[model samples]
Target chain A: MPQPDVVDDESVAAVEAGLDALDTPTERRRRFTWRRAAAVVAPPVLAIVLLIAVWQALWAAAFWPEYQLPAPAAVWQVITDNVQTGVAFDVLWNSVHRAVLGFAAGVLIGTPLGLIVAKVRIVRAAIGPLLSGLQSLPSVAWVPAAVLWFGVTPSTVYFVVLMGSVPSIANGLVAGIDQIPPILPRVGTVLGASRLGSARHILLPAALPGYLAGLKQGWAFSWRSLMAAEIIAVSPQLGKGLGAFLEEGRNLSDMPTVIAAIFLILLVGIGIELLVFRPLERSVLRARGLSGAF
Target chain B: MTATLETSAMTTAVRLTGVHKSFGAGRGAVSALEGVDLSVAPGEFVCLLGASGCGKTTLLNLVAGLDRPTAGDIALSTSRPAVMFQEAALMPWLTASRNVELALRFAGVRRTQRRERAGELLELVRLGGLGDKRPHELSGGMRQRVALARALASAVQGSQDGSPALLLMDEPFSALDAITRDVLQGELLRVWRSTNTAVLFVTHDVREAVRLGQRVVLLSSRPGRVVREWQVGDLEPSAEAAAIEEINTSLREVISSHAAA
Candidate 1:
């Protein structure tokens, strides 16, 4: 009859099917674009460069006396000299060892204490305020009591660090538990999860972000407490830590050595935060979709 | 359609009698529900349609056993009724399949057959290949599907007496787009027919109530009580679109009159 009746029912059906297939949504892959990576990394590197430049310019202008603000080169010289003599390395090792031990102890004692306070109404009401109050008290204040109790030994330093950091770690966990969305706990109940199982599976995971935040703050406290203990409770029996190095510089009136020690302390604190805590925080936030970038 | 009309009291899956609930105490007390009586027979789909302060959610909560009635009682012939919320409520940490598996596990599904049952449920909801994906990775419609599948799994695993399962839904499709809502309504009907579950759905949308429910129970404003009930006939595709419009207009009139009062 006609020239194929051009658009037959079969042809029309085939066309519609093709359009449906085209309209169907497909999952797309998400990638970490290098441009975004560069954008994130650039600002910090530039700021560091600017800071160094400003310091060098101040030194060039001789704005402050060398005794007050030592030049970058002078501080570098002190680091090199101390390294060659192995003193800087010893001090670094001593400070790191104390900080690590303090952090471990804080986590151990604080985690359980937090769980108890969060779960039990009586315990929370009784000790919650005390825990937060203890966090505000300066770790240096513990030095005298620790010395009176343990004498001028590593144990005294350890005691001071624990008193300083444990409260913050525990409070963090308490806050974390408080912040967990109520839905999760309900889900846990529906699933027949026992109290312990709920704590382990639902409550803990839900509280992770808050807990990590607490750990970050706890580490800072640990570091600061160790330094205070090291400087104030110094003895021949106790090894030289970063704080002791700064004190020795003060005794000798070696401005460059003091600057070098301060620089090392700042560097190590930033390094730990950036390398360890930041990545942990990022992963947790991203996993929960609380962060902008996955 | 005929099947729903023929449902008898003997086939009741869930029944609530003289249920009363109130918040606060003494002089300041606000009643949320009062003397509420309702029943859903096996294989029936009932919608509790109401305005904002109508206690529809409170009623569903009682049925789900999330909260107990201040007075009276709610009884189910089988195990606890499964509930679905406006939000998908899937655990963010688990894959879609694992979320369904969790419900099955809780309902005492055998350990060896849990995965297979979960997979079957995923297929039932048309999310067969999405088992391993996290909730965040799925679309809003997809997440709700997983939620529906999870609720169904719980119902299936726990339902005794060979009766249809009981489902309590609190506006499960309120968050979806119209197209997605339509698709999910179809899916809901398919699943309901296949599983023969008795659904007590709560929604503010009148068209949705007419589209999905065999019986629509309208509730009065605060201190909610049954105000009116309508038995909607078969919403066959040819007449559904027109019927929905007419029902929506009437629902709008009812809401406006209540607002004016």
Candidate 2:
């Protein structure tokens, strides 16, 4: 027999270290810096400034009459007036509180509903198409039926928000569950995980990106549905929300207040997406090495 | 079942008796393996060789308890066998040591001991300092090493009465480049020797089977059945040129017969 070369721990370690050096990629750690922040923040701020400037020019040119297409300053003045009187906080609080409560309820209902739809074939066959159909049908259309059922109470607003949000949340979870690679569950099984154990350890974490996406979409739907309810389901007992304020402006022919309400609605929508969901999604994606772009 | 019981005195890591597996039922049924009878003794290294569609992976899956056979029986000494796939199959979201810990956890290791044991397992695979790195951060070879550590942890967990663990590997090195594969095969041998685990390694590479296995078993292609076996004796299979040539010649005959059929 040919004498085999002596195998030692030292030589193996040396060989492994050499191979690793050749193969290990030098990773560039991207630090969060002021310059990166400015790069992201600058464009949107500049766009908003340009929009105001164009509005001012249009008002100066008297393109449509002052009452119909009011100056940007007039809309700002209306917002400032509401803030001074503390009406902005009150109306903002009422709408936001309703949205938060409705979203929480939707999550409770939608989670079990999603789990059932994803796992049970018979249940999925029966209601899967219905959930998808409900998602496409505008939640605003439910406001009229909600008002008729609940008679402009807080329940009516919550009912409309739930209708808008549930389908989106459930469908998002179902889609996430569907996207998990088949190898993952098989790996779990071979590792000796039980069915429940696999779901807890493997399936849920793997499905997070999809579930988070569903939650973000569900929030958006709830907000839109709440606004529709506030505007259409009018009663003296109902607190004045941004949507209600906009409706009052239309009744009194106050264009500045109408524009102000529209701006507040846009601001709140973008704020929640930026402050809550975006950071959460970015972290989850980054942890999994799925984040390629900022 | 009787065949396994008959061999109980020597004790085995795993034994398959008259194992048959089929994919579907009725008119469209496809058989993958037929009448497969194989066994791996504790701490023995056996390589299962065959052409593509020879049901090597199907046999491993049956041994791993991932699937039931259409007929016959498979019995194992341990509660479960550790399995390694062509891909590392580590969870992307977990760190390397954490991935190893997951297997330990499933094997019912206490939380207090899991971290320390996981570290030891990583050291055993020569992945000592890279434990905190995620799967994506490691090279393909490093990821496979972590997977090896995880498999070792699983084996330790399933072992009973100081018995050696059983490991099922399905072409675990096929995806690697030549140099990495050589390094890993050497590493695997070292690990296998020190740990004293029984390994049922499946591959289509004849040279690899000869290089690693104490005994090499050959299966005919399509609805695979054991066609032949060769004992490499005490000398290294690589050094035994006559034995290597004999096994290769038999393998060629099996492939040609497949073509003819």
The prediction achieving the highest TM-score against the true structure is 2
Query: Model 2 misses residue B233 by how many Å?
Result: 5.3
| Model 1: fraction of native contacts | 0.11
All candidates: DockQ: 0.21, 0.51
- Weakest ten-residue segment in model 2 chain B by summed lDDT: B1-10
Which residue segments of model 1 deviate by more than 4 Å? A1-42, A60-63, B1-11, B105-114, B160-164, B233-261
Q: How does each model score on TM-score? A: 0.85, 0.95
Q: Which sections of candidate 2 miss by over 4 Å?
A: A1-7, B1-10, B161-163, B236-239
Q: Model 2, range B16-119, lDDT digits (tens) per residue?
A: 88999999999899899999989899999999999889999999998888888899888788777899999999998899999999998877789889999999
Residues B23-107 of candidate 1: C-alpha lDDT, one tens digit per residue: 8899999999998888888889999998888899988877776677788767675565677889887877778998898887665
The CAPRI quality class of candidate 2 comes to medium
